[model samples]
Target: MNTYKQIEAEILAASNILITAHKSADGDSVGSSLGLLHFIEKLGKKATICHPDKAPDFLDFLDLSHIITMDQEPEKVNTAFQEADLIFCLDYNSTDRVGKDMTPLLESASCTKIMIDHHLDPQDFASITVSDTSASSTAELIVELIELSENGSLLDEKIGTPLYVGILTDTGSFRFNSVKPRTHEVLAILLAGGVKHYMIHEMLNDTNTASRLRLQGFAMSEKMEILDVNSVAIISLTKGELEKYQYKKGDTDSLANLALSIKGMKVAIVLSERDGIIKISFRSKGKVNPVNALAANHFDGGGHANAAGGMCELSMDETLDKMKALVPEYFPVQ
Candidate 1:
C-alpha cells in the first residue's frame, strides 16, 4: 500500500485521533497540526490537537478551541492521549521536541504513531515517519499527503487557510531557500480553492502588540551586537529586560531574521534569559554559511542549517561571550 494511502487508511480506522506539535509551538507546527486535524475531520473522524504550549498571540486569530495544551490543561491532555487510538506528530523531528512535560506520555502511548516533519535527522520512533527535509514546511508535506490520498477532493478552505499560513511563515513568506516549486504549486491549489492568502499573511504579521514592538526595538537598538570580523549579529536579553517590555510568547520570534537583514551579516542569533537558561534562536541564509552547527555543537541544540534553536545553562552575559568567541570558527572572516 502507498504510504500516504496507508496514512489515510489509519485516519479512517482510528476511533479517536490526537494530533500533536513540538513545544514552543511555531507557525508551521500550529498550521500543520490544525490542517491535518481538519483533514481527519473530512474523513468523518474528529481529532484533538494537543500542543505542548499555547501558540504565540499573533496566530490567535485561528479558532483554537478544539486544541488542548499541555501547559494549560495537563489532565485533559493526558486524557486525550489516553483516548486516542492513533496519533499524528507534526512539524517535529523527535519525541523530545514535545518537551519534558509531554515526552514521557507520548513515548509510552500504546497507540500507533505517525510522524510528519521537515527536519534533519528524524529519529526512528514513529511507526509511520514522513520526514522530508527538502520541503519548505511540514504544512507542505500535509498538502502533499492530502493530494496523494484518494480523498484529495476533501480539502477545502478550512484546511487550506492554516496550511497556507504554515507555508508562509516557515518559508519566511516564501523568502527561504527551503521553498521549492512544489511549495508554490500546493499554494496555488489552495489559493484556487479560495484560501485567502492575504488574510493569513496580515493576521500573522500585522497583529503585533505594543510590548512586542518595544521589546524588539530595545533588542535591536540596545542589546544587538554586530561582529563584523565574522559577519555575525547577536542580541542578548536578560529576563528583566523581557519583563520590562511585558514580554509574551513570540515577541522575540523575529529578532534573528531582522538582525540577519543587515547586509554584512551572515549569521544572526538571538539569546534571551528565561527559566534560568539562555534560550537561543539562530537564523542565517545561504548554504555556504549554515548556523545549525553553532547551535548543535556549542549550545546543545540543532535544527535546519538556516534556522535552529538551543539552550545554554550559563548566564545571559556568559552565553553571549561564549557565542561571540565561537563565531569565527563557523562563519570565519576569510
Candidate 2:
C-alpha cells in the first residue's frame, strides 16, 4: 500500500486523532498541521491540531482558532493527547522538537504515532514515518499523501491554502534549491483547486506591520555587520533592542535573507538574544553546509544545508565571539 493508503487505513480503524508540529511554529509547521486537520475532518474522522508554541500573525489568514496550543491551554493539549487514538506529528522529526514541555507528553502518549516530515536524519520515534529529506516541505509531502488516498477530492481550497503557504514559505517562495519540478506540479494542482496563490503571498510577505518595517530598518542600520574578507554578513540583536521595537514572534522572519542579499556575501547570520539563549539563524549559498559545520558541530541545532538554525547560552557578545572563532574554520578567506 502507498503512504496515503496505509495512513488512511490506519485512520479508518481509529478516531480521536491529534496532530502536532514543532515549537516556534513556522509557516510550514502551521500549514501542514492545519492542512492535515482539515483533510482528516473531511474524511469524517475526529481530528484536533496542537502546536507547542504560538503562531505568528502573518499566518492568521488561516483559521487556526481550533488549534490547541500548549501555551494557551495546557489542559486541552493534555486531554487531546490522552484521548487521541492516533497522533500525527507533522513537520518536525524528533519529539523534543515540540519543545521541553510537550516532549514527555508526546513520548508517553499510548497511541499509534505517525511522523511526516522532510528533515535530515530523523529519529526513530514514530510507529510510521513518511520522511523525505529531499522533499521541499512536509506540506508538499501532504499533497502527495492526499493524492495517493482514495479521496483525492479533499484537496480543495480549504486544504490547498495551508499547503500552498507551507510550500511557499519553506521553499523561500520557490527560490531555494529544495524546490523541484514535483513541487511546482503540486503547486499547479493546488492552483487548479482554486487556492488564492497571489493573495496568500501578499498575506505572508506584504502584510508586515509598521513596527516590523521600523525593526527591519534598525536591523539593517544598527545590527548588521559585514565581514568583507570572509564574504559573510552578521546581524546581532539583543533582547533590549528587540523590546525597544516591541518585537513580536515573527518580527525577524527574513532578516537573514536580507543580510545575504549583499554583493559577494556567501553567508548570513542572525544572532538574536532571548531570555537565556542566543537564537541563531544561518543562511548560506553555494557548498557551505550550515547544518553540518555551523549548526551541528558548533551549536546544538540543525536544518537544511542552505538554511539552518542554532542556539547558544551565552551573552550576545560572547555568542558572537564563539561564532567568529568558528568562522575561519568554515568559511576561510576566499
Candidate 3:
C-alpha cells in the first residue's frame, strides 16, 4: 500500500488521535496542525491539536479555542498525550522542537507517530515520516496528503483556509524562492475549494497592532545598524527597549526581513533579548547562502538556507559582537 493508504489505514484503526506542532508557533506550524485536524475530522475521526505554547497574539483572529497548549494546561495536555492512539507531528523536525515539556510526553507516548514537515534533516522519531524540504510549507503538504488519500472531495473552505494561511506566510506571501509551480497548483486547488485568498491576506498582514507598528518603526529608525562594507544589516534590541515599546512575541519577526531589504545588503540579522536568552533571526538574499551553517555553528539553531534562527545565552552586546565578527567569514562584503 502507498503512504497515504497506510495513513488512511492507520486512521481507520486508531481510536484517539493527537496533533502537535513545535514551540514558538508560526503560520505553518499552526496552520498545518489545524489543517490536518480538519482533514482528519473529514475522514470521520477526531484529533486534538496540542501545541507546546500559545501562538503569538497576531494570530488571535483564528479559532484557537480548540488547541490545548502546555503553557496554559499541562494536565490536559498530558491527558491528551496519554490517551492518544495516533499522533501527528506537524511542521517540526525533531521531538525537541516541541520544547522540553512536550518532548518527554511525545517520547514516552506509545502511540503510532507520524510526522509531516517541510524542513531539513528530520529525526527518525516517527513511525511514518513525510518530509520534503522543497515543499513551500507543511500546510501545502497536508493538502497533498489529502489528495494522495484520494479524498479530494472532502476539502472545503474550512480545511483550505488554514492551509492557505500556512502556504502564504511560510512562502513570505509567495516571495520566497521555496515557492514552486506545485505550490501555485496547490493554491489553485484551495481557491477552487472556496478559500478566500484576499481575505486571508488582509487578515494576516493588515492586523498589525499600534504597538507592533511603533515597534517596527523604532527597530528601523533606531535599533537597526548597517554594516555598509560587509553588505549586512543588524538589529539588536535589549529587553528593556523591548519593554519600553510594549514588545510582544511576534513584534520583531519582520525585523530581519526589513534589514535584508536595504540596498546592497546580502544578509540581515535581528536579535532580541527575550525569556532569559538572546533570540536571533537570520535572513539572506541567495539560495546558496551559508546562513544555515553559520546558525548551526555559532548560534544554538539551524533552519533553511536563506532563513534561519538561533539563540544565545550571552548578553545582547556580546551576542551582537559575536554575530558581527562571525558573519564576515560566512558572507564577506561584495
Candidate 4:
C-alpha cells in the first residue's frame, strides 16, 4: 500500500485546511498548492490557499483569485492560519523559506502540519512529511497522494492543469536528470486527462514582451562571462540595468539555463542585484550537486541537485568572485 494512504485518512478527518508554498513562488510551488486546493475542495472540505507574497503575473491565468497573499491580505491570511485544522506546506523544506513575516504565524498556528517537498535535508517541523529528493517536482508527489486517495478520478482537468505546469517547469520541460520514467508516465496521464500542453508552452515560454527579450540579449552580450578553465559561465545584472529594461519578476527566469547551453559549460551562475542583496542562482551538469553541497555550504540555500538558489549581502562583483573561487572546491576541473 502507498504511504500516502495514511495521509488520505488524515485529509478525510480534517475540516478547515490551509495550503502554502515557499516565498518568491515558482511554478512548481504555485501549481502544487492550487492543484491540491482543487482536490481538497472536491472532498467538500473548506480549503484556502496562501502565499507569503504575490506570484508572478504570467501565472495569473491559473484562477488564483481565491489565493490569499499575505502581502495583499494579511488579515485574511492570519484568519485562515488560525482557523485551519490542517496546514499543508509544499515545495519548501523549512519554515524560514516561507518568509520572516509568515514564520511567526506558522509557528503559532495550532494545527497539524504536513510537508510535501522535493528538497534535501528537511527540518523536523512538520507533523507529517512526504519528502523525496529524487522526485521531479512536488506536483509529481501530489499525484501520488491523489492516486492513493481511493477516488482516483480526482485527477481531472481542473487539478491536472496546474500539476502539469509544476512538473513541466521544475523538470525544465522534461529535460532535467531528476525526470524518471514515472515522471513521463504521470505526464502522459495528465495529457490524457485534458492538460493543454501546446497552449501552456506558448503561454509560459512564448508570451514575453519585447523589453524582456532585449534584456536577455543585453545580459548575454555585455554581462555574461565565461571561465573556460573551470567550465563555468556567469551572468551578472545590476538593479540599474533591470530598471532600465523595465524588468518584471520573472524576467530572468531562463537566464541561467541560457548560459548552460554553451557546449563546454558545465555550470552556470546568475547574480542579480536586488534590494541591497545579490540574488544567486546556480545550475550545474552531471554529478556536481550544487543544491545539496555548494549552495548549502557557501550561500545558505538549497534545492535540487542540479539547480539551486542563494543570496548574499555582498556586492555583485564580490559575490561573483566568491562563486568563481568556490567552483574549484565544489566541482574540480578534470
RMSD of each: 1.0, 1.1, 1.1, 1.3
Candidate 1 lDDT, tens digit per residue, 287-323?
8889888888999888899999999998877887788
lDDT of 2 by residue, 1-334 (tens): 8667899898888879989999888999999988888888888888988899789888888987968899999999999999999999999898889999899899999889999999888999999999998899999999888877988887899989999999999988898889899999999989988899989978887888888999999999988988888888999999999999999888998898898888888899999987578999888888753534678787888888888888899889999999888887888886
Predicted structure 4: lDDT: 0.87
Against the hidden reference, what TM-scores do the models get? 0.98, 0.97, 0.97, 0.97
Model 3 stretches with alpha carbons more than 4 Å out: none
Q: Candidate 4's residue-wise lDDT over 1-334, tens digit each?
A: 5568877777889988999899888889999999899888888777899899888877877877978999899999999898899999999989999988888988888789999999988999998999999899999999878866786676788988899989998988888899999998888878887889888888887788999999999999999999888888889999999989998888898998899989989888898987688888888888853545788888878787899988898888888889888878877777
Q: Model 4, stretches more than 4 Å misplaced?
A: 289-291
Each model's lDDT: 0.90, 0.88, 0.88, 0.87
- Range of the 10 consecutive residues with the lowest summed lDDT in candidate 4: 287-296
Rank by lDDT (best first)? 1, 2, 3, 4
Worst 10 residues of 1 by lDDT: 58-67
Number of the candidate with higher lDDT, 3 or 4: 3
lDDT (Cα, 0-100) at 258 in candidate 1: 95
Most lDDT-accurate candidate:
1
Error of 4 at 146 (Å): 0.7
Clashes of 3: 0
